[model samples]
Target: MADRTITLLIVDDHPVVRDGLRGMFASAPGFEVLAEAADGREAVALATRLRPDVVLMDLRMPGGGGVEAITELGRLGLPSKVLVLTTYDTDSDTIPAIEAGATGYLLKDAPRDELFTAVRAAAEGRTVLSPAIASRLVSRVRSPHGGSLSAREREVIRLVARGTGNREIAAELFISEATVKTHLTHIYAKLGVKDRAAAVAAAYDRGILG
Candidate 1:
């Protein structure tokens, strides 16, 4: 390994997670954590100012979120590489993040050594993914019925799985029936199913609806 240290900016919504990561990295050699951000907006700001070699980013947050921050970093011409450190392994979560410019993806449950390796590799502009996430991506690629869906579309499908009709689903979600229909339409298109029943089955099969 090189003698130079790899600087990092840790971004996560949970203080406990940030603290854990900070302690873990602090205990390890050749890893310097410059700062921690509670949300993606703050991460983007600190990253722009600090320009750490790697950004350990959490996908879901109160603010703009990891993918948005990654996109913003690119738009601002920041050279920092982003490594997604999140719990989500779904296509809806992973695909947008990759498309938004994440250099790597690793689950929050990764072993300490693996996490360290991922960070170091990401700093060097290499791509990484946890085994589970890689499997999800591979399965998604192999199955044409598996595709990404927006939050609203997911909500619609969940209700469909619950055997709720469009009007009832709309009322439960505070959206109009037409809006629910539109969401179902989009969901069907994305999931490659022709109707609500098939959509629900595909979603459950793909782990979109639990």
Candidate 2:
């Protein structure tokens, strides 16, 4: 019959940012600031010990970035939902953090009310992505460059994006060197690239790899 309180662990490298967030949340209803952390590593430790319901995480920190922290939480099998609150919104930043298991993504310029709403949504295990970031993700998924590549071709492209050699990729995927070359050839054709370098760039630009 009573509303449950949502506990939060605020993670940011800046003390002032943490102070502002803490102050704001401390004044809000049905919310509690369980702890404050200056980096991703500290956030993970505090999240493990404090068992907060939600973590307001910053993506780029000095030690062990937010992506790494989010991943560690996933490995530890913690139930806390991570809400990314940071200034960065580029594809390079957003995609990895989301793929790393963040429950929500919001820009720092968000209004106070929207931020509160996002935190509550994240606490409920709901996916919250900023409008700009959401549009980019949707556009990336619907981009024309993706529809032509096969699953195997995409796998090879992903490896290539990571600078993996054909022989190494073949060994990792348990396939022969010739098969890897065939996949690369198809990837090149589908992505309209000439060589591995172009293919790698194309894959990332097309949102096939990030």
Candidate 3:
């Protein structure tokens, strides 16, 4: 059987960076560049239109940028897996971007091989974390602050991490969908996260989920 070909869309504000990435992926086997976007909104629009297997997204962009693009893509039920590329190595950027539905994070300085590998992995629904970012994820998961999340919140977080939607969670837990939403609202506030991916990331970070 032929190997599956992964379709990719590159989303970055810098022309030089975009060109460099396009060049790097040129020789990678079983991957195709589907489109390129100069900003987050364009990224979302293009990804939506192209329905590529993967998206290499930049974290910072002007006017409703990277994180928001990821958020919108998630809400719209787009199938593209997002891999964030950025210079910022801090937890704030990594965690939030992941929360925004990015499947992985790679630093801007990563070797071409590593970036390509990460992108391919994400296309297959796997999570990849750069070494520096992984450490922060470990530390955050081990933080004492997360102990404050309630039992119900923890349950909701578990289900969410398993990719269960609110309605399904409500059905499984024998609660109204509104109740599930309430739980998620509290979960978000307690975790200081804005979306499902972030909640899942935080849960894994804190050793609360497998």
Q: Which residue pairs show collisions in model 3?
A: 99-198, 141-205, 141-206
- List where candidate 1 sits over 4 angstroms from the true fold: 145-210
- lDDT, candidates in the order shown: 0.85, 0.85, 0.81
lDDT of 1 by residue, 1-210 (tens): 257999999999999999999999999999999999998789989999999999999987764567778878989989899999999887767876887799999988899999999988988888999998888888776875445786557767888888999878756654446657877888888888899889989998989877
- Cα lDDT tens digits for candidate 3, 116-176: 7898789888999999999988987887764366555677788888889887886665445
**Residue-pair clashes per candidate, as listed?**
0, 0, 3
Worst 10 residues of 1 by lDDT: 170-179
Q: Tell me the tens digit of each residue's lDDT in model 2 across 119-147.
A: 88998898999999999989877877544
Instruction: State the lDDT at 49 in candidate 3.
Output: 86
TM-score of 2: 0.71
Worst 10 residues of 2 by lDDT: 143-152
How does model 3 fare in lDDT?
A: 0.81
Candidate order by decreasing lDDT: 2, 1, 3
